[model samples]
Target: MSLNTIDIVVFIAYVLGLIGVAIYVSREKAGHEKDANDYFLAGNSLPWWAVGASLIAANISAEQIIGMSGSGFKIGLAIASYEWMAAITLMIIGKYCLPIFLEKKIYTMPQFLEQRFDSRVRVTMAVFWLGVYVLVNLTAILWLGALAINTITGVDLMAGMIFLGLFSVAYSLYGGLKAVAFTDIIQVVLLIFGGLFLSYTALDLIGQGNGIVAGFAALTDQAPEKFDMILAKDHPHYIDLPGLSVLVGGMWIMNLSYWGFNQYIIQRTLAAKSLEEGQKGIAFAAFLKLLMPVIVVLPGIAAVILLPELERADQAYPQLMNLMPVGLKGLVFAALVAAIVSSLASMTNSIATIFTMDLYKSDAKPRSEQHYVTVGRIVSFSALVIAMLVAKPLLGQFDQAFQYIQEFTGFFTPGIVVLFISGMFWKKTTANAGLAAAIGSFVLSIVFKYAWPTLPFMDRVGIVFLSCLAIAVVVSLFENKVQDNAVDLDGVSFKTTAGFNVSTVAVIAILIAFYSAWW
Candidate 1:
């Protein structure tokens, strides 16, 4: 799987060009400097397209490209539910959630909790978010990306990981979210083009008669079992997909957590110039999400026909690159790197935001905006360093990185969702209940995890979500009737634009058509 000179040359050029673009977009006018608002939230001035592009660029990274492709090889198209479901989740957030957050003028998710509940809840979740971003999210992205680079170019895995970490810092640390957001548009274009080509190459160029159509036909005919949209209870992979739960159950919790609440992900939407801009950005991302399976998942399913007997499912994507021709192969590899580095930058940038805004700002005395921005840079760099050191050690052993991410993250998502629901809608919900929901979500999940091991985690998540909500509700009722901090939605309309409505219907129709055909 050696890369040709052209492939190497193209990837290098893309990296350099991306860095230049980031620097250019991030420059402040003379006598103005990068301040906290400017650095962290792009000064609240991103356009819809940039926000949309940044959202996808920050998301469809090494995990989706490499890890989920591995799942496609192992679990088939059933794996695409995560992406498909997310389109719906993004719409829900845009219509119902983003307006509130934007109206509140918040920078981070933890900050929202602070405003809605208390500093106790904010600090509790801030610590949890920082840990997850660094330990799980950052480490997984780096290690899995390094593994893919190793597979394609024979680059040493550790060396590849280090290069990726440094590469992200080179572009994003200086400019913060503005640089990351603007440059992400290019990364996404590459990701989509490269991913689609790789899938096509796997089907058409790898000795299949005719082209991609023929290759796809071969996959469906030869491996009909791989095309199921939902797993059966008796299916070997049922524990992973867990039948209908991928649609009607825990998968929603997962999507809501990632799209609506996660600081690292929602940070892009929070940076929009206005509520309308953010929702439009979300609508744009929803359309892109509908296309993601074609780019990311299909390649793995294609691998089942093209390269069936691999040691690991995760290897399916990188190994498929070995089948591609020279110049195009480099383009695809660059695309892969684009996803990895974009996410790395986005994650580190987010880690800095939460640390600086929720933790540092709350504790430290008032300081110059430049001082906080400097601290943010230092924190971002430190997060990258910490993640690089711990990545392989924490994530090296997992064969299918995507499922590991879902399973581990599942532990806390149900509880977080409960807290948010209570904070926003339930007037009687107390800070104690919010704090209790936070702890109770984890404790109950642990109980379900070990005590009821056979419960499919997707099901487990749904049950735990209900359980946590109940716990929070009961606790809230016992303490008080509607707390003063509950959100006042008097004039806040959840009504969306007609354009957004049309987009939502289109997405829903497409999802319906997709599931029906596959089912």
Candidate 2:
């Protein structure tokens, strides 16, 4: 669909504004002579509010907006399970996990492993995450975003892909985590507004006379098969076996490893000024997580009813956007850009952080802040180039994107999380045990993924995670305890006013439940 002049202008204006923010932030970073800690970790000074917004912005991107909506249109409301379950996972992290990281004062997830386990394990896991973060996760999103833009506009796919890569690279290279967090605040706002608009517009098209429940009923009647939650046992298209394997057996393992351990998400908690702030931020993100189904998933379901002849599920969001009146169309496009850029910037900054702290500064003589910042720019530029090249090959396929990127993360995350929990709480979990858990889990997941492709992706992840948990438990039990190096979690304060604000959480929870019921 070709956009009108106003739509084009609005898109250009929004992009320019983001570029301006990036340039302004870079100047600030330059002025305040910053250290590696300040550049890489945002000085551990981001308040709870910023942390909350940034986390949501980073987490909700083209994957959720484009990929998620596509899944919803094809599979019905079951896809919303991903967003809702995240709330429960965040609560677990805030209550049980944040205290340990805050107390230990670790920068990267790998660093935490080093202290809990050994250097060999830390390096192994570090290399693994670095590869996944850059190659699989970031690359897929970048390509998908470019594909959407190319489909919507007349721009060349390769050129659009390169342009986006450069834009994300420049800002992330210069502003570090501070820029990523601040800009993400704007992104989250735009994304929420854009999504609500699409939902409202779609419902309006269905007819202003009907309430949300009636609107959904109308859609379901028009396309009864799309609303089918249980894939027929004998149906060839039914993924019941895979779905059952993925949903029951694998999802928990994946979520636990991700929300519980991943560095990109956890880095926000690490940057918090205090444990209270971290917990507050996590809880806030949890509340926002509940809204995703309405904004991203419901719209997809609406698309199925509204445009029954549409060939591709991934085309749903853009097609809906094309139907919007002029002003609304621009805003939605801007929000999509915001979502994509926030994720890109977050990944770029994290890659630089891992390189600077985990790889560069660990052994080399400590360099000046200016020198480190220079290296950061070079590293970001280099990574962006690699991601861009990878994005070209990632276009068109949605199922492959999810499985290829997510399944492998399970192996390392479960093992790392198990070790971290044991390291903090149990006195018997030695460094050797942590190392063993990580190595064992990594090898086991690879075996599971290739050896048993029919076993459902999520179930395999669950098996690997559980296996790691068991190995960590057994190994830690047998390993010798450190005589004097044992960590003390006693001094860490959990009584602060940082716990989940029940009222706010309750409101968000109610809204999510109401929407799900209506759907």
Candidate 3:
């Protein structure tokens, strides 16, 4: 995949333009180096559009671009459950979850735990999240991004990793979440356009240049099996996707933990100007999520039909990129890079936010807001450096990067979800119960992974979630209830503006139509 002069210019211009936009938007006003609020939560002033765009930008990283595409290549449209399910999850979160989070005025997920449970639960979960964000989330994005860049440009993988790390750190370290969120607007736009361009061109090639409709028709006619949204038990890929469980089982656990509870993801909505603004932004993201498979997943299915002999599934996306002519190739490549860098920036900012707010500020006592912001920058730099060093080695072990991420992250999500749900809704859930559920879920996940190896990971997640919920309930029964510490139940409304309601209904209708067509 060699680049001509036009391609080189387009890619270089796109990179420089992205950096310039991030720097420009994130620039400090005179006499106002960001305080904790400004740096961490964008001064709690993100408009609905920025919130929606940043949410998608942060969520769709190299993981979706490279990894989900790889999964699509290997297992077909079943991989799209992650994206589609997330739409429904985001809707539920916006309606039911965001109002509580806004009313509480919490900055991070760990902070919410502390408010509802205790500092012990908060600190334990905080440390665990820090490790996962730095080690697993950050590393996977860098590793997979570098691999894609290496495939596209023939750059050394290590060099690509360092380049991406430095690029993400350069802007995000100074501007923090404000810069990350605002820059993500452009990132999301490029990612959507670039991804669509790639998918469209690939489909065009399949149609022998007839048109997208003809290409789609040829695609279905030739590779009908690749379009299955549900897999049978005997299917080779069943262990990963597992049919109806995707709709009714552990996939929901994953989506809830991710869209509802994950810090980097939810942090965007947390920055919204008001509860209404946040809800609308989330609803907007839900609409975009429905379109994601066209940009992210369909290309891989197209790849299978177009380039069937590729040795590695991960190579599906980049190999498809090789089919593009000069300028479009660079635009698509820029979109890929945008996806990677934006996610890296989002994760780095999140790692810093969690560390500075949940850990450093808690331990250091009240400092100047500026002081904590500085600490955030330091943590961001340190985490990025560590991720750059660790990413290459970790990714080498996985045959399917996306599944490896899901299965490994699955280990802790069930427990985290149980803790959050119990603490939020159940007044009887004691702090000890929350802590015990957290620890017990991890132990049970380990047992499922090692001792019960034949269990599907999704099923394992469901089992662990149910078992941990039971454990928390039993433990809470043994402890005295503290109703004062429970999440406030007053004035919690699922109501939204008419526009948002109509949009939500439209999204659900579209989803139903899709499943009917695809199933």
Best lDDT goes to which candidate?
1
lDDT of each: 0.91, 0.74, 0.89
Q: Which scores higher on TM-score, 1 or 2?
A: 1
Model 1: residues >4 Å from true position, as ranges?
A: none
Task: Give the winner by lDDT: 1 or 2.
Answer: 1
Clashing pairs in 3: none
lDDT of 1 by residue, 1-519 (tens): 789999889888998999999899988999999899999999999999999999999999999999999999998999999999999999999998998888888999999998988898999999999999999999999999999999998999889999999999999999999999999999999999999888877778544557978888887888888899999999998988999998899999889989999988899999999889999999999999999998888889888877888999999999998888888898999999999999999999999999999889844479889999999999999998898899888888888989999999999999999888778877788888888888887888899999998889899999999998898889988986656777998757798999999999999999999999999
- Pairs with backbone N, CA or C atoms under 3 Å apart (clashes), candidate 1: 427-482, 428-482
> On residues 63-181, what C-alpha lDDT tens digit does candidate 2 reach at each position?
77887787777776666666766776787788777888788888888887777666776777778778988887788778777766876776786787787777776566667888788
| Model 1 poorest 10 in a row by lDDT | 200-209
Q: What does the lDDT read for residue 31 in candidate 2?
A: 52
| RMSD (Cα, Å) of model 1 | 1.1
**Position 352, candidate 2: lDDT:** 75
| TM-score, one value per model | 0.99, 0.90, 0.98
lDDT of 3 at 191: 93
